[model samples]
Target chain A: MSATRDLVGVAWTGLMARKVRTLLILLGPIIGVASMVGAVGLTESAKGALQVQLATLGTNLIIAQAGGTFGSQNPTLPGDAVRRVDSVSSVTSAAATTNLSGVISVPVQGASTYYEAFPVPVRAADDSLPSVLQVRLIDGRWLDSADRVLHLRSVVLGSGIAKQYGYLPGETRTIRLNNTNFGVVGVLGKVPLDPTLDNAAFVTQWAAQHVFDTNGKPNELYIRTKDGTTAATATVLATAINLGGPDQVSTQVPSNVLAAQAQANKTLQKVALFAGLLVLTVGGLGIANVMSISVIQRSSEIGIRRAVGHSRSKIGAQFLLESLFVGVLGGVLGALIGIAVVYLVSSLEHWVVEIGYGQIPIWMGLALLVSVIAGLYPSIRAARLEPLETLRLG
Target chain B: MSTQDPADPGPSPDPGDPTVQLPTATGLAGPAVQPLLELEGVSRVYGEEVEIYALSDVSLQIMPGEFMSIVGPSGSGKSTMLGLLGVLDLPTSGTVRIAGQDVSALDDPKRSRLRGQSIGFVFQQFHLIPHLSALGNVETALLYRDIRPRERRQRAFEALDQLGLGARADHRPVQMSGGEQQRVALARAIVTEPLMILADEPTGALDSANAAHVLEIFAGLGTPERAVVMVTHDPTVADTALRKVSMRDGRIVADERRVA
Candidate 1:
């Protein structure tokens, strides 16, 4: 008997019966939100994951003495200060290592003394290197403590290094790192981030020290502070140790690297926030306009209802309900599509995509709010129409 | 509820005894001799660039339960007068009293309510809602009341049954014959049980047979409790009314009684 119920009945009948037109009316926001959600998701994920990728060296690492520029082609982290950091912290684990590329000679059949050889990059770690920079071994054991003192020609070649020398685990092959021969002890799996590391052999500190002939402390220090000590605190501690030391060797809490990473994250998060807001604003306005226009067109139906005893508010509510239906549908669908795209992208590549700690939920909520407001304004307009005028115009 | 009750003597005295009976076709159910509606100086003005007077100073009165007809040429303001009588339109200046209440002074919503409760409308176009069935079109008058859905359908069926249209209840306007559709329209008009039925060219949309059938139904509706007012242009149709009046330029030109 109340005006609104009948209006709702009338609106519901028309909308439900005309399914395609209703969906077409809602299309603008759906497509817009989908594109916006997917793009923003991918960009933020790529930025955040980059920081983690850069910080994989697990130790409190600091470099000095201008070996190379930061985030550059040749040198961000120095290779010589690894030992100095070990002496600074009692529980410290450190190593100095450099990348080398040279051929390793192997005697071939019918060759009396000389042999054909192939070139490869080499890396030498300190005795405590395994403790400082861990390797995920595919096969064979790491170089033992005895391998450092003996100055033995023993080495651990990476998978690429093994492939270059045509060698595998338990096989005999020699690789010359900086013109020094070292026996192949093992092969590691592919670390695509550094092709140089992948192709290089792991040599002991003494062999590398004797070969390179640079006993000048390491180019950088990679130290492990005791647990419960902040990376910043450890860096502070290292700075304190280096400030008064003769070597000018600095200590850094590796956590600053993580902080640097998160700084990038913060900026990316802000960008994602802005993108989401833009989508919501535009999408909301579009939905609101469309809903309002439809309400205007249906004013005659509204008049007919009024003449039949429908109230003004009832007409308004019917329109509002239609708007709300659109909003809820767009929101849930946009979120689901956003998360699905993130998943597909992450799986096919090395990307890290997380929907929970990011703009996805916020955007979805905004979309929902937009949809609600879209319905709300039209509802009010419909409710305010005079039954008398409506009937006349109709 | 027998068709011929044994307790009710059949046309007592058969017009043979002075005090016993009346021999009129609708004897006991016939209309009382009292006016049910009165309009004094009813005028409707239409204003555009220049003000056009649609109806000016129209006055008329209809006795309760009498069959009345209003005939006029095109642009004669007959529709305007009927609109005022039905409370569908307000008089620009004048008084319209229905059942002794000055309805022109009542507020718009109250007037509308009064029309819904007391008057039924039958228009030339059949005016049945296209989406509704014949029965549904008839049932629209009961929507504003608190009657239940099943009861509403029952009453609608009863009205259509009286029009001899019980079989056409499920048909739509397009599906029914012109005669059937108009009979359905007539059924719809009387379904609300209003005090008076107003027809604006009820037979204007129908052929001769359908128009005759609609006229017969209109004639049958004249009784002691309800009255009928129909607007027409045809003399043959106007001749069917118990009383026929003529209008020209919003004023009555003639008023007369049918010879039976």
Candidate 2:
């Protein structure tokens, strides 16, 4: 133990004797570890945000849309497609909706004489739309089966449209669309995953078929699978709905999209890790170079120690410990700086900062190992020096 | 004390036998008075293609309590002889024995251990680690020993104090004069209480005053269980020893006993 303490003292003194050189040698590893931590933290936070967003969107939901070109002339899903999807064993609920683009006009607030028109996307959805889309009604009740059966001219305005038109729930307003006036019944809050949904208008399927002449067909279908089923159920539903074959319809599962996104993130992380390793390699080389130079400069001191009966291995261990010390110091400083950088970025982006605290040991361990490896050659060189020759040279 | 008297020489003992004891005129005979160091037909050759015999067919012996000096001009292989005696290098074709143990056959680590246990070295240049304190430098001699830190420090302190540098224990080599640095080196050398002390031109860099002081210190370290061997080129320093050996062309030409 005393020998070890003496070795550490001697190594530390050697480093402290040349302050500028030691500091310069330390910079490489410090920068390498700091950037590595920062990159890892940044990637982790992004992945966390993505996971939260996916959870908010509900993983069980899948979207099926008419395949091929999308335009006014393209054929959409038949009216019975929703019924066909609902009949699938794995599907719990399904809703079909057709989108239409039109202009809407409303009287200026507190100035009934003036009118303003804005282009808006309109969605015609069944009574099951709320459950399938997981949308929340902020102002009034959602559409019921009676509203669809009665073919009532009722509409729900998205929050953005409501704010634009100065419309409120229970306040009857005429929304002119395709030369027909529809009465507004409710307004929806912002949807978590789909930002575009906040600018759309919603109406019943019967009203859309009668007023817009959509022929009881829908361009989009939203489905909720049973508790354990996933995108595979979408394939089954697609095959059942599109009796014609695979090319006639398309299916999408949000979880699958998230999986692809996570895969891309993994690739990015691997690249970042490679870059980090490259930087660390440069840092390791710097340590090796410094240790080599130290060995040469301290050759006489080494001879003195050897003459006093220090073994070659002891001399080697002293230099190795010096390099290891530098590496550990760099690791600590880099970790702090990296965490700070992560915090600053997370704060600016309003992301939940996640710095896997468990990885701290691994990072430091890696740094130490790298330093040992870097110091190996130089330490061996120092140990191979002949005490007689060194003393004679001096 | 007696000066040199030409006594009849005894038969040489077999070099390979560890039990053999050679006769000496010191009156302290038997196994207890055995020579502390011995070299038998030692030779050291350097360079591969162009051979150079740094030391050739050299043989010498020093008993306990003996203060001996090896005086030679340059190229007389004094340094090479010192290296072999200190176990810093092995003789190419001969045996070196310290305290009755054959050292040339030992491995590097064992050789180092033997040197640490039995031999102390004082160089001409006072090779003290520049960054370590005087006490720290002295303590380094016992770093590999099985001693505790507190004891190591205490012993090192005592060694420094004995050299009259107790108050300067915390000073670095750069902060001390040449004589003080050499004293610290001496303190380091003696901290282990080795059987033999080897001084290689110890006062080569000192003035006459400092040299005399160092010689006085060396004179005070002689004991029945310990020996001091100094290699020097200065005849004035050589005269301070009780016995002296002059070397020429890697061979001892004169062995004289001035004081006994």
Candidate 3:
């Protein structure tokens, strides 16, 4: 029948009376909850970043290339491979490219003091490569079908190669390819998915067939499927590209790799949550330990309270209240620490900070549960003490 | 153990001991009044295998306004008798009544409620909770009484101030002297203004000066509406009470009433 407020006050004072022990008890929940929260936060943030990347570049990209090993005759992609892949109902766009022999060098103007220029790889690329690969133009036009059909000496420079040759779009800047001059049609932006393209020089089939004397067959085929059809398109892309020798073509879907990464993240998050709960359980045990010690150490106080008209049950309730208060405090601290961890890690990794704010209350409730469970035995023990005996002992 | 031999019949009550012969409620009180507390043939036993009689067939009555003491050497069972009188323990084979209610028959909560409403206890060690301020410790007695918090605090402060501890009400037990702590304990016991105040070796832990001060306070605590019972082994401490009941071999051997 004690006033609940008074009992709570007593519990509060009891916890405040032993600051160091209380802090030690708080540590378990704090770290446990923090790690759990941080794990979920980091995973979520990474996933969020992945979504943005996927949304812009699309998850339906497929890379198909010749399947021969080194020192063997490398099977070539059919000259009609792009058209064949594009013709598939699920395929959105298709393009192909092949690395041509000999590097392209930017011919230096006389008296220019620029450091020695790095030779750029020259690749025979389709006119549709820019749009299918999601590569934006930083300067001028990409090679068109007209250039390819008319055998024009038009070439495109990636951003790195453009900067090397000091070529601007619309300027008649030319680069040396097969000892013949080719006009730079445009400079492509940096491609995050494929950094090697940043230093490559792209030429249409006109340059490949006329100057290099190479067949117009592409070595690599890039295919884009409609949304939700990448996996299904991947199964048939090899056969669709080279029907006669589907085994000679190897098709890889980059989106599947991303999906695997996401799956791994989900698994890691589960493990983190489990670890967090385990730590929370340990913290709860710590609370019980401290409560037990408090009961024993405060036996005399218990006797005093009993003599002052506190019933046995009231005594138990007081101890339970103390532990509950400690638990709640630990939960709050743990949650705050957890959020801070998430933010800290997310910021360090330059990822979007994503936190499931709704889970905080649940986590705190867990702490309370742990505390009550831990405090039960000690509180009962406190209640069971004989008033007279405890008074004598005290 | 030799001094406590049940066969010795040592130190019988003198012929002038009126209260010793007046054991019944009628003899202790007028026809219209009931004794505040009464014990009828109470015996408390311990041990299941071998019985030990901590208190034996002892009967006594305490009237309001009585300042009394139960004194005995070790193993005389005065502590056991005190426990029964305070309603803290149930007797093995007798009725213990407080304010006309049978304490032994009541369950734990009911008995505890009765005890809380009727009796307050003071200990020799001045058992003030160390973490709480003097006011908080005193307030412990008034809790579970359905009193408003503001009123409870007011009453607790008044009790502390009554015991000349007003200036130290905010101080913790560790910050107080032995005398101050005992005074705080006294404040706690009287904060609820119960029918009886029970003290167990109240001054055993104090110096002579503090003991005298605490005894003086005890001497002034009993009133026409309240009784004060002191249990102690010290002769000087027992002498402070107006009525002295001495026990031996778990039996009341003497009951002497003195005129102040």
Candidate 4:
């Protein structure tokens, strides 16, 4: 152990004797490692953010819309489409949704005016609307099958609509759509991702058909698959539904979109990884060049040491240790700088910092390995130096 | 006589002189004291197509307590002889024995160990490591030894003090005068207390006063258990030794013991 420590001390002294050259040699690896770490951190955080956004749109939900001419309004789905999709083996439940523009009146508490009229968007949906859209009810009750059978004029208000009209659960507010009035029975909590749902009122499909003449049709069908159903099953269902309506229906599975996005992100990660390795290879070359010069410059000292009884292997080990020290020092400095860069950029972009701490050891290990490989030739060259020849030159 | 084989082992030409005696196969004519260093018919050749003979048919011996000087002009193979004696290079065809061990048969690492344990060297340039302090430079001599760190430092300090550089122990080579640096190199050389000390122009870079001081130190180092071999071109420096060997064209022409 003492022998090893002595060799390490000698190596350290040799490096300290040439501080400027050492720092200059370290610069290349420092920049390379820093950029590599920073790129990995940035890519990971971006992927995390994308995953969060994808999660907001439930993975199991698939939206099927009527595919019509681009400029024209999308054609509505047949009235029985919801029941037909719900009956599919892979689909757990389905809901049909339609939207109409309407006017609503809310009673004023302290004014002489009897009511105030405001434009409100209205949606027609079934009892399974909350399950299909992943929505929660703040108060009151949703429209059930009995209401549709009885043709009761009942409505549910979104949080935004409720706030705007000062409507509460059990409130007898009438909303007029195409000169027909419906009673509000429930208020929904905010649906952040679906802004249209947050600012609209909802009623049963039967009431919507009777009141607004939708002809028993809906703008879109929302299907929730069984727990184990894959995205391919959703496509199969959409194909079955559009069997007689060619070029008139479109299918969208959020999980499939997310999978495609993840695949592209993987390719991008691989490219970035290749770039980082290329930079590191360049840095390794720089290390090799500097180490070669160091060996040449210190040939006389090596000869002297050999004459003083140090073996050639000891001399080789000393140079190898010096280069290893540079590698470790550069790795440590680069990791800190990379982390700092990652944090700064992430904060600026309001992204969650997602650096993998586990990767740090692996990266440092790789840097050290590269440095050792780079130093091998120089160390061997130093060891092979004939003391007689070197001292003669000196 | 010129065409006769050099390895005939017969009396050399001009054998009438009694002061110079060629070494025989039975080794030096003394049985009581073993020679500290011995080279028998040593020859060193270098290069391929156009071979160069650095040292040819050189045979010599030095017993303990001998202060000998090898004096020669340029290209007389003084450096090559020193390298062979120092175990830094093996002779092309001959035997080198140090303290009765055949060193020419040892491998590189074994030879290094033998050099570390049995020999010390002082170069003409005072080859002290420039970055290390005088004490640190001396300590390097014991680095390959099994000495503890504290003992190594203490011995190095004592060595420096003996060289009259106790106060300059902390000074680096660049901060010291040439003479002081040479003394530091001398201290490094003697720190190991080896069987022999080899000085290659030890005082070549010193002034007359510093040179005298270094020669006094060298003269004082030759105890009954140790020997010293110095190579020099300065006749005045060579005259300080108890015995002198003169070389011409890679062969020793004369070996004379002076009345001290």
Candidate 5:
């Protein structure tokens, strides 16, 4: 028999002789591998993009809101809930907010009697609320502990309310709430995670209890934990906020949603990979059909080769080598097409591009294995042909 | 015909006869000068229910340094005889030997190896692979052998040059004329330098000029170390060989040697 290199050359020449037929046969494997590669790359790129967004959105943030159940018509956290939560081991920061009982109206300009046209709710926030929520102020400084100690009656207007009143930091405008005049301290920007806060006005909890007759009980507690500790912090946060009755509060860690989304993405990847493999099997069948037809068409060539000196196994090897060439070429082309698709889709969607370049060899190996299996029958049939009969027939 | 028919031509001494076992070309010169191929009482049969003997009790000896032809009309078993002589088929009832080894005793791979190393075939239709160039077609004979690519290419070029086809080595079969294609097939046959060349109607598809040229090349190919056997139906083509064996009804009717 000839050396494998020579056989490869012969096989290559045979394939090149029928360029159109070979390319048509290659189409199946190319599309199959392309779908598989594209699916993996796009999912990975999407996961990378999600991770970036989650990192910026703060994975360690936990929110505990008082919820009413069957036993209680109204549920409220303990008055010292933020203090208790701040004492937890992993808690980096804690804040609380509670709305006042009655609606507060901003007086219309040049009107003696208040029309109550814009009844923006006034929320009482702790001194650390701005830091825990990680909100940036468009103008002026955040409310501090000294504002509560001195009862300065300072108010920070949310972005939506500030825009409505044309309020800016250090402006001479005084907002009157419940017949008490409060100086504007800051104007908050948009809060993407919590849009409800974008329409409310904030004041210190101490000032709310003293001037606005609030019950001094927090309705919601926002806690920031150490990095990678959100899940652990959430487990103990409800009990920490309502020790007497932990069921009165519900804890939510937004990072868990990201984890669930990752799990869903993993499932989608498996399903897509299975679909790609199904198409690959069909492609392999296509190769088998082409190879079989090639064997039939080249029977005379087989006869000549046999008469010349080729053993049956050598003839089989030559045919298999041709099939392997198809597989490897298709794999390379498919991988390139898949990478291009991933980059195109990722760029259009503004996602991070992540390709598994390391898996390319494995994909090629898979194609080789598939083609070898597909070509087995045809090669063996070519080998089993009777030299005399084929020669006479040809 | 009976096995002991008196019509057997005995003018040339049989190499297997005891009297010729001395220091001569047909003697024990370390087995090199023995008959290149010998078939003793070889018979091929077909059909299970109704037996059909393609060849029955056919005994023949083909010596080295011989240029001979087997000529017969269709259905006279000449093709079957060629198959047995080329080691492409085994007999049903008797032994066929090539270079002192029994043909039927070898396995498929061994038989194929022996055929490849000892016998070369030229077909009637000039069955050159159309995709390969003339040189490439010649190299195919040596592909299954142990020769490296450089030497193989060199040898193929030499064979094509010997066929007066040196300038057309790069032409594919489809691009060449019928005569050139036949010459390329001849190059492929002789490239391996086998012990025997078996040509089946070598010039059947060629014009008179190409046929004469091919016959001339065949004449020069027979040497003391090799044998050339041609199977043809044309009496004119058979006349060119030094020895001619004529067959009819599955039996050798005449074995004649031309006066040199």
Candidate 6:
């Protein structure tokens, strides 16, 4: 093995001796690996774009309806059931979401306040939930069960609703729901959770119950799993929650919209497989060509080696090892360049581009494997060639 | 003095220029110790249908330190004989014993081991790898063997010193003259301190002056520990060797021992 490595070092010297050919050899695998990585990045971004789009889908969520006795629109899960889902094995978080139609007075300018019409989702949640639905709270704190006293009609407004409510955090404002008056507790800072649900005000389900003053029923029960258990945990919890009599709660993943995007991405992976394989094939061919030509060009050198008692395998390994190296180099460079291109293009368009760094490691490792196989073919041929004839030919 | 001795173990020389065999066959003075290399009835034929006899019915005994030259025409299979003797190519029939080991009977790896340990090679063309400097070229051959890099460096320098090339150790092959490159190649070949050096036309590409310098190096290699068997076509080149043998049509046609 050491002998082989020494030969490879020698072979690489020979390869570097011919830089133009080496560069040409690197082109195919680079483009191939780059395209594959770029496809991966684009697929990743497309999926994320949908996640931002479907942050409003609020799917990947488990919604609670009244035990099939209440039906779709009117079914309301009890408040206690919402807390039970929170403690489930895979459930990282749970929240009760209720919507209340209300009229609010917002300070317009100097003397008067305007009461513009807007309805909002009133979510009563533990603090962990702000991250679960992928919402970013730009300023102020997320709603927590610990701060129950300050919870009276306290609001965390979406970016748009925060603009209109004209009420800042710590400012007193009035809202009327069900003909009862309530005071604003805390104004929600700007956040991107559910765009459809953003215009609505957020208050405790307790406060919502007081303002709307309905019974202890909730329209939706939302739960998010801990990280790394998104799919399996979501499925099991979704299955478990659905068993609450007649599929009253159904589970959804923001990833599902992403998965649909990833289905196209699934197709992209197939294309990537073919592309990566093709890139490797082309890279291998470059290796083969360069090595075979090296054999041709170095016929006299081969003769010298054979005459000096170098085995055929040693000669062959030199050429092959050179190719393998070029392939791996090209794959690495391509992956890097591809990743850079993805990041470059994404930031240029200004969509919320999420090129997940997690996917990179596995695919790059695979590209390296392809390069080794590519380098072997021409090397064997170079090694097996009849030394006498090769030398005589020169 | 040129007449044959009856009890002489040396092969009967051809009538042409049959001089006295050397009185310096080291162990021959005492009870005969093992010869450094011995070939017996070795035959190598290529292809089954219409065989080309590369080497046939050849026998030779090389005592340690003998400067032997095998002179032959281009197709006379001198290279083949060199390959067989060096253990690079196995004889199809008959045995090749190197320092008392029947190397022909060994496995491929063992044959290579014998080639690595017992023999070194120099070729007609200077085969210094273009990428390596002269010193690096010599060191490369030792990288696979048992020698450590430091010792290899020491041995390579010593070998280059033997060829009067120690000062040119840093030069690449292209930078060196043809004679210097060939000398570097010879240094690379003999750095392993093998028992015998098999050179196929080592000075074939050099001018007579360069060739004379290489012949001197080969002559200087004559010592009880090692031997040199060179192949050449020039009679003057062959004459410089202490013992000259000629081959033709895949068989030894002349065996002559020079007085020198």
List each candidate's DockQ score. 0.09, 0.38, 0.35, 0.31, 0.36, 0.20
Q: What share of the true interface contacts does candidate 2 keep?
A: 0.51
Per-residue lDDT over A18-85 for candidate 2, one digit per residue giving the tens place of the 0 to 100 score: 88888887876777777778878888876667667677777888788887454546557766888888
lDDT of each residue in B169-210, candidate 5, tens digit only:
999999999988998999988887777899999999999998
Clashing pairs in 3: none
DockQ of 2: 0.38
TM-score of each: 0.68, 0.82, 0.82, 0.76, 0.84, 0.66
Error of 6 at B260 (Å): 1.6
Q: By summed lDDT, which 10 consecutive residues of candidate 6 chain B come out lowest?
A: B16-25
lDDT of 4 at B85: 88
Query: Which regions of candidate 2 are displaced past 4 Å?
Result: A1-20, A66-92, A101-119, A137-176, A179-199, A239-249, A262-264, A327-340, A354-369, B1-32
Residue pairs with backbone overlap in model 6: A60-A252, A60-A253, A120-A200, A155-A188, A156-A188, A157-A188
- TM-score per candidate for chain A alone: 0.69, 0.79, 0.79, 0.68, 0.78, 0.56
10 residues in a row with least lDDT, candidate 1 chain B:
B16-25
What are the per-residue Cα lDDT tens digits for candidate 5 across A1-394? 3477678778899899899999988886688788888989999888777677666768788889888677874466888888899889999998888977574746334432542554687888887777787878888877887898887888888898888787755687787776777888888877655667888988888888898877888788888999988888898887777776655788887566775564327777888878878877888999999899989888889989888878898899888888888889888888899899999999999988888899866776787778888989999999998777777711
**Predicted chain A of model 6: TM-score relative to the true chain A?**
0.56
Q: lDDT of model 2 at residue A27?
A: 78
Pairs with steric clashes in candidate 5? none
lDDT of 2 at A232: 74
Candidate 2, residues B1-260, lDDT tens digits: the string is 11212262223332221111222223344675677899999999999899899889888988888998999988888888889889888888888998777887777767777787678889998988887899989988887665556867988999999999999999999999999998998998888777789999999989889999999999888777679999998888988999999988788899999755
